[model samples]
Target: EAGVAQSPRYKIIEKRQSVAFWCNPISGHATLYWYQQILGQGPKLLIQFQNNGVVDDSQLPKDRFSAERLKGVDSTLKIQPAKLEDSAVYLCASSRGQGNINEQFFGPGTRLTVL
Candidate 1:
């Protein structure tokens, strides 16, 4: 089985600039999630999607962050007017379903640096 794929392994941008990250999950996975991991901290879930519909986005900063899994296969996360505090590794993960015991596969994150 193939793993998830993300683009632009690293990025640097000035404060208030905009950036976007792309993700391609494993084929057949029905649940996708985006997470933010700061240095020295655990990953925090930003949004969850089941198919093309959003399941949870309460932790996502709507004012700056937005994400979508348009075809239930690929996803994109964008941050406009990014702040310094938004610097982190954006991780994309996927699972077979919404079941409790599903194992998640994560991609190499896109690391963002805000200057």
Candidate 2:
């Protein structure tokens, strides 16, 4: 089976600019997640999607960040007017189902830098 896949493994943008990242989860996975990881911190869950519907997004910054999992297969995350503090590695992960019983497979991640 293939693992998660993410595009633009690296991105650099000026502050207040816009950037977008894409993710393709495992073929049979039904649960997908997006996470942000700072240089020295663990990954923080930004959003979660079960099929085509959002499951969680309380941590996502609505003012500048948005994501979608259309068709319940591939997903995209966009950050408009990016901030310096937003620079981090964006991770895409997927699992067979919800809950801790399932193991999540992760993509390499896209590293973002805001200048």
Candidate 3:
């Protein structure tokens, strides 16, 4: 049994540049989530997907941040014209279903640094 997978564990870029992160959830997991965690703060939910359909994305910044779960398996998160404030860890998680009892498993996360 394998866990979630993420790419480019660390990234650094200028404030105006763009950056993208990738994630592959565990097999048979029906729900996927993306979160943003700033230093000293708890992770914030950015987006969620149930299978290939988007379940929630209200917290996602449409102006610069976007994410998608393709075919209900792999996912990608991108930030365009990144801001200094966007420096944080992007976390990917997955669960079997939508319920409080369902345990969500998280990936290692991608650390982004904007200069």
Candidate 4:
């Protein structure tokens, strides 16, 4: 099976500009997630999708961050008016099933640097 894939691997943006990152999860995985990892901190869940339905977005910064999982497969995360503090890695992962999945495949991530 294919592993999760994410791109640009790195990004540099201004504090008020907009940027987006893309993800392609492993085929046949039933659950997908987007997470934000700040320097020296664990990754925090940003959004989750079970197929085409959102399972969680509780930690996402609604004012600037948004995401979508269309067709329950590929997904995208976007930040508008990006903040200086948004300079962190945006990680994408996926598992074969729902809750209690023992493991998830992770992508290399898009590391954003807000200038």
lDDT of each: 0.96, 0.98, 0.94, 0.92
Question: Which stretches of candidate 3 lie above 4 Å from their native place?
Answer: none
The sequence of per-residue lDDT tens digits that candidate 2 reaches over residues 7-66 is 999999999999999999999899999999999999999999999999999999999999
- How far residue 20's Cα lies from its native spot in candidate 2, in Å, is 0.4
Model 3 over residues 20-68: C-alpha lDDT tens digits? 9999998999999999999999999999999989989999999999888
For residues 16-51, what per-residue lDDT tens digits would candidate 1 score against the true structure?
999999999999999999999999999999999999
| Count of backbone clashes, every candidate in sequence | 0, 0, 0, 0
Name the runs in model 1 displaced over 4 angstroms: none
Q: Summing lDDT over every window of 10 consecutive residues in candidate 4, give the lowest-scoring window.
A: 96-105
Q: How far is 31's C-alpha from truth in model 2 (Å)?
A: 0.5
Residue 13, model 1: Cα distance from true site in angstroms:
0.6
Candidates in order, TM-scores: namely 0.98, 0.99, 0.97, 0.96
Q: Pick out the ten consecutive residues of candidate 1 with the lowest summed lDDT.
A: 64-73
Tell me how far the alpha carbon of residue 109 in candidate 1 is from the true structure, in angstroms, after superposition: 0.5
Candidate 1, TM-score vs. the true structure? 0.98
In model 2, residue pairs whose N, Cα or C atoms come closer than 3 Å (at least 3 residues apart or on different chains), thus clashing, are none
